[model samples]
Target chain A: MSAYEKYLRNNRLPHILCSGCGHGIIMGAITRAIEKADLDQDRTVVVSGIGCSSRLPGYMDFDTLHTTHGRALGFATGVKFAKPELNVIVIMGDGDALAIGGNHFIHACRRNINITTIILNNNVYGMTSGQFSPMTPQGHFATTAPYGNVDRNFDICELSRAAGATYVARGSAYHAVMLTDLITKAIFNPGFSVVEAISQCPTYYGRKNKQGTAVDMLNAQKENCVTVAASAKITSDQMQGKIIIGELHKSEAPEYTAVYRNIVDSLQAKEMK
Target chain B: MSPTIKLLQGNEACVEGALAAGIQFYGGYPITPSTEIAELLAEKMPRVGSAFIQMEDEIAAMAAVIGASLTGAKSMTATSGPGFSLKQENLGYAIYTEIPCVIVNVMRGGPSTGLPTSPSQSDVMQARWGTHGDHPVIALCPSSVEETFWLTIRAFNLAEKYRTAVILLLDEVVGHMRERIEIPDHVDNVLTRKKPSVGREGYRPYQPDADLIPPMASFGEGYRYHVTGLTHDETGFPTNDTEKAGILIDRLHKKIDNNLDDIVEIETQMMEDAEIMVVAYGSTARSASRAVKDARALGIKAGLFRPITIWPFPANELKQYLPQLKQVIVAEMNLGQLILEVERNVAGKAPVHGVLRGDGELITPTQILARIKEVQ
Candidate 1:
């Protein structure tokens, strides 16, 4: 059997990242999901912004677009609408997805175009020397937030669900098997789907906060995450400190492009009759 | 030369022109005074294997047109007033990224949602600078339906040639009127995209070479490339280097500026020894044409200088005629926007007379005739 990992740019392997970089893990899941779903590799387009995670496009064999900062999802929306035959994937860092491009993020979900957005939440910015991100939890110190973060973190699955995304799921790189399944399901979904992967950023986030090592960070994610059903049974007081990981939402209204096509067809048919 | 006859309203000829231009992809949400262009394109584009989509809103319509053009299709979207305002962000995007697409604004009167079904040539300046930032633009305005056909063809041609967003400024009177238009049979002579010689291997999308226009390889073409709105070098990497950023911006200006003479196309009617020249564009200029003839009959040395291409402003050519003239009457459906450009170009060489209108209607021939007589 041919190894599905053949689609990766193996020459760029043993990534240039330091230990516990979340990008490597998130990218592994996305490319593997594309392969597992048997998507047309040529017909896949990956767009990314100007974060460490954005480099995921350059490492893939697909028709990748490395766009400006915060605009990866915008370009991905265009790519998907342009050719509905193509499986469009947008990989974004937390800052690229929720901070600089927060407006576009919600709107793309609101429009519900057929795009699979994989948001890599590492809590701190890695490329710009570890700045704090919107997803950085309280008391997480970074270059920008030296005195510990006081800002509330964004739950990406909740944001995606609220913004009308048809499919919303969360997984951690620590749960490698589950990540593959979540990403695979997202890729096969017909409408807008968001897979938020809580991966490790030991070099910046962990080192600054003294979270031992990459392995420790991974263990933290595995230990902190509880089932959504289990969390629902618990009170808000119990859910305050723990993270919930599972599919949060899935339903269908018409995707934007298909609805557009239908409008044109119906207009023409009415004119003919 | 084939016989040129005037028998079409400004909008009908625009339809014929868009059809002649091989615009196979049209996605628009209809707003008035430009709805006929969308209606006509919807009806006619499909007859020729084109796809017409009435999108969810003007934003998606504008966005989809750019997407379609990137996929190697000549595409356009049309709107007026409120819809035009909604289109500027994506329009700004097109200007910044140098995407080749056409936008037709059959202008109507308003600052905000004023008169939807009425005619007004108010969007002339918006066509030039509607989108934000310091970017080059090519906005073509046609006075008649025939010029609409010709200019729409040129809008497509210039868009393909220069890689910029070209606007077709129309007014209500021109769009809904029917007339005879001889559509062009073939437009293969118009430039298609320049394919990357680097092929699919190691292709950088925004890396324009010496000519400053990079070849585009489509998405499914196996050529992985990047297009962004950031300041970047030839490798398409986002850069913070000041000198490199300046060069990239300068190249954007140079691509349009260095080729302005080919870009600025105008038609002068009897400017050899005319004492008064009435300069106008869009349907407002059609009124000026009759007024000039009426003034000539009144024994005034009045002539018409109408720009088929409103942008690249035809500044130098208009300046050439400005010095010898006593009065240059500028008339439009808007209060005063293009008049500013005219006055700047004239630069105290002559008094630039302004005849303004903003009542959701075309400036009547009589309105322009009074201006010609008053200016003379």
Candidate 2:
């Protein structure tokens, strides 16, 4: 078996993701990252909500939890608290993380637990057919918005940084190597970390918006993205129509479980005294 | 832990009972009538090496409780009406996954938070059918403070034994009312979910043994199994085959239905040869219990049939009372929720009359007697 195949559940193969869905590539990147991190399979948990990206965890050979729509982070918080030794990673979609699960997404960041969240942003509700998600670009047509979505899109990396995530980054399925590195770093971060992987949904969002084939969407991401290093030197006007694909933000903060553990230990010790 | 007698409120007893039942995690938001459960647990859980968290919303609270339970902890959450409504989504997830946890819903008047401080039994049907899909439910209603303590432990035990969520139904009256009781130092019957007997590699997470209960494996126990809300086979992975889905649904129901005798619990006093029976639960049973004694003193053949376990309905056990019962009085603090169930079970064997009070007041013993006299 290949190294990536070792991380996947062989019996559950032939996953249900769309033929041209970028989620498969993102899943590959995540598995490779997990392998690179050398995480113990018995001590790792992958939690996801209801969406195309959420389905990724089911295909992985871990103690995977496919929870309710938009509630993966809340569930992950409990898992991390109940047993702080286990590594918890959450895989979510644009709709799962930024739309229906926005409240939990922000709060999870604010709490800064040792969870690595990978937001697979296809910018549409791919699993439920094409619908405008919170990350959908303005003027993009969706099933719910036939006339094109007028709502502004969220810069997910900025949102995560503002919500107090200690480490925040953005990469794309187009940048598989960089995405893997970002995910690996996020997993190793002591506090809450988020890596937003801008993915493509050729069957829905791509077809609805006339974005040609799956390859065309990947090429577009390659042509439009600027690295964080280049982003710092470029002016705002010069960077229009360009997405940044690299580590966007990184900082240090106290992890939630560690702080809670300290509080519990001291209180119990004082009682023992 | 030491045995001590103390005057305690019903909500306080719930907290004590949860502690005795080995509850290790509590994730809840503070809602009126049920806030005391969270407040007390928050202050007390850490001292006993448990974790108490105040979630942002009721959905997260329910979700977090399930997550904690998945890690082999006895977890719980408490909410009232509107919060309970928010919790139903994840509650359905808990039901489908068969995650063992307890949810304490202290009843409050509602059609969207109608009365936060007022008590009502309007959520009786909601407690059974609040979530979207058809699933098995175990709900226990306690009539007194002492019973609340013991039943709370029973709720945990049933949840663990059946691998399902158990609702500890309380009302504002019983939750806030204080009563003196002797608290046990150590509860002997506290039960935990059974772990898989085989090694992690040999375990199929959803494969049931002789008792129709699958042995549970915690997340970090080297058993890297998958759990989903979708229809799944014995391997605990989602399946799309209609026949497989049908079988899965049937098995979920049968697991509780086939073992109804063990799960359904009801109490009866002066039921033999009684011409009239008052069927009540929760705090309302207190009045009905008294009314039965009062009627007996007056030479009226009245009896009290209290359902300690309300949801598996105890229909067959209730059927035994219909032969001699000429009239059945269904008394509750709502506009006839459980009465409908009584009427269905009685099936014209007797005249089932409803004595309901939905104006945020308890149905007094006097009103119950008046109903009995009217039926006569």
lDDT of 2 by residue, A43-67 (tens): 9999999989998889999999999
State residue B255's C-alpha deviation in candidate 2, in Å. 1.5
Error of 1 at A220 (Å): 4.9
Off by over 4 Å in 1: A1-24, A38-41, A48-61, A66-77, A92-113, A120-166, A199-220, A228-241, A248-273, B1-16, B39-57, B177-180, B184-190, B202-204, B207-211
Q: DockQ of each model against the real complex? A: 0.27, 0.85
Range of the 10 consecutive residues with the lowest summed lDDT in candidate 1 chain A: A1-10
CAPRI grade, predicted model 1:
acceptable
> In DockQ terms, which candidate is top?
2
- What is each model's TM-score for chain A? 0.94, 0.98
Give one digit per residue, the lDDT tens place, for model 1 in B322-368. 65799888888888988998889888988888889788766778988
Give the Cα lDDT of each candidate.
Answer: 0.79, 0.91
Cα interface RMSD of each candidate: 4.0, 0.7
Q: Which residue pairs does candidate 2 place in steric collision?
A: none
Expressed as tens digits, the lDDT of each residue in B47-156 for candidate 2 is: 87778888878998899999989999999999998999999999888888989999999999988879999999889999999999888889999999999999999999
